[model samples]
Target: MRKLLLRSFYRIYQSVFKMAMPFLPWRRPVLLEGAGSIKKLPGLLEELKIKNVLIVTDSTLMKLGLLDNLIKELGINGCKYAIYDQTVPDPTIENVEEALKLYHKHNCKAIIAFGGGSPMDCAKIVGARVSRPKMPIEKMKGVLKVIFKIPTLIAVPTTAGTGSEVTLAAVISNSVTHEKYPINDFCLIPHYAVHDPELTLKLPSHITSMTGMDAMTHAVEAYIGRSNTKETKKAALEAIALIHQNLLKAYTTPGDIQARAAMLKASYLAGVAFTRAYVGYVHAIAHTIGGFYGIPHGLANAIIMPHVLEYYGSAANGKLAELADHLGIGKGSQSTDQKANAFIQYLKEMNQKMNIQSNIEQIEEKDMPEMISRALAEANPLYPVPRVLFEEELKELYYKIKG
Candidate 1:
């Protein structure tokens, strides 16, 4: 009886501790930036004693001449680097294999990911694959499975969203299965992350809006998530403020560097927050839709965020109210329920402002059941979500997003 009671008490203690851990300890190496900071990449590499580096990115960014600037900067610093510019949005297992080949062939001691989430994710896989050649990337799909320490990595973000820089999670799609698998390991977080706003100046308005919404979703989910701690809450609050203030400005005027910078910083902070606190149903549902329909991840979240928050409101009322006040809505609410509704309205209003549209046709009604199955399977294991979801409820949420 004594032993059984002790075990039960330990379980309870761990459960509560997960809920209450304050300012949850998070660690990432130095972040350096400015318009000219990309020029400093060479010196950072030298300081780390890295000789050869592999640059991981995509063709679009390369076509935009972004990689050329990086190459010039590296040349000025006398750095040796090779380009692996085949990263695609929602990178596939085949993409990882090819990048891994380049990683080994070039004998790269370090890796630089220079696009959005895809490049960063591909870089993470490269690091893992290079560390252990015989270990299949498929086996490293779950959290903390990449046991080997990876090569030194640096990430430079060209988009204001995704926040892949600070995140330990990487999303890779399996072409054969058409499933997006997340590799979650703290070992994958980059050694240095640079958020250069200047790099985002050329981003189109639609992409800016979608990415900024992604950042906002990160803040909202982090704040109300089951994993919310004092530290994560602080990070979430700051991210919310920055994203709220600057996303619209950035969207309306894509060339506004100052606004772009604010969104970039907000996305980075949101990444930092969610990296430790984890995300909730918004991401859970978004990832499913993204994989099944090839919908942009950020846009999917933007459309579905209001519905997900509504479901979460019952269990996460107080936190939602706090977010309302942060967004300057419903200060003198009649009750927590009222405040939560108002908060949801604010989200809807923001979506309208951003011109995000959703239709049921976008997500086939016939496929709702299967999407829920996959989403639940992917989400429940990691997210400290406020409430457990049933198949019917998830289907309802899907319909709501479609509407």
Candidate 2:
């Protein structure tokens, strides 16, 4: 009876939210796509009359000199810039705070999120902190909390996955509490997205595989969830097709610019889809694991996604079957169950081929309770998942994925 009442409440909340979706302030970033597109950003900055900016990125990217070209172009364009390269994977609140300090110290007029999702997430939250100086980051935890407009934010993705360039979410972690959550608002969306495939050419094969699978997870979650709009569904399908065609090619041949470009576009589209439609338990659970154990977000999603889909069982069959057909995976004569299983099998095989672990070895048994609690807290009454699970079912999932 308690479970039934809770589920009914969740559905009712989701229904009301879906009805309001069309009225939400949805916006897309101005895209600078194609090869050498990173070169276009300095001119955009100049046009915007932004003289000082902060570049938020991870130290690895800075050490590799990946920002050399952008830095040079900014200087040539007469723009002053400050670098905050301390962002780590599953960016912490400290990362945002540190970057915010840099933004203030340099009197930055804008923010440039360079590198992958971590940097992007950090940069977005830094913008949020700047906008709401009095409000704590924890106060802006859920949807539409950052009502104030952020600064002139630009996203430059050095990786083909995470799709942070087009997303309105900034996933932040509380290192002390072992909690991870997303702060979502239309204002968090970057003003411009610079997609330059050249930057992704040097990505190692493993990073490519993990991030590609991350994009796939986003597309799949958005398609299977109940809150999708027509536009979101269309973007999800296109993203899925692109990932199916390009992920393996990009993985096997790291320097294939065409494949890299396709994957990058796919990531951007998936970002668009999920940013509006939202993700499900896979993301919820993955975020918890990432926060608790500091696991790579993409790696956790890849391992946990299959398990969550299998748990959804009949509830997800129709959508999974449709995806299977889209991927040309099953015969017309096959049952929906067979087709769905085949699709799941394909994901598992892809993981194996890419050397992605089937299970996360980092999950500890003792952490299961807190992880499950955090995952449930993140999903319920928020994510419009196809099938919702409470404690027992979520516990089973944690144990299944535990190494």
**Best-fitting candidate, measured by TM-score?**
2
Residue 63's C-alpha lDDT in candidate 2?
Answer: 82
- Runs in model 2 deviating more than 4 A are none
Which residue pairs in model 1 clash with each other?
23-231
- Per residue, candidate 2 scores C-alpha lDDT tens digits across 296-359 of 8998889998989998999998999999999899889999999999999999998999999988
- What TM-score would each prediction reach against the true structure? 0.92, 0.99
**What are the candidates' C-alpha RMSDs?**
3.8, 0.9
Q: How far is candidate 1 from the true structure (C-alpha RMSD, Å)?
A: 3.8
Kindly list the per-residue Cα lDDT of model 1 for residues 1-403, writing each as its tens digit.
Answer: 7545643554464366476545334458579877757777788887888878999999999999887777987787777888888887889888888987787788889999998888999998889887767888788876778867889989999898888898888988887766776888878888898877888988888889888889888888888876666777888999999988898898888888889888888988899888878887888888888888888888888888888878765788888888888888876845888888888888788888878874435788887777898887777546777666657779888887777
RMSD of 2: 0.9
TM-score of 1: 0.92
lDDT of 1 at 172: 86
Give the residue spans of candidate 1 off by over 4 A.
Answer: 1-26
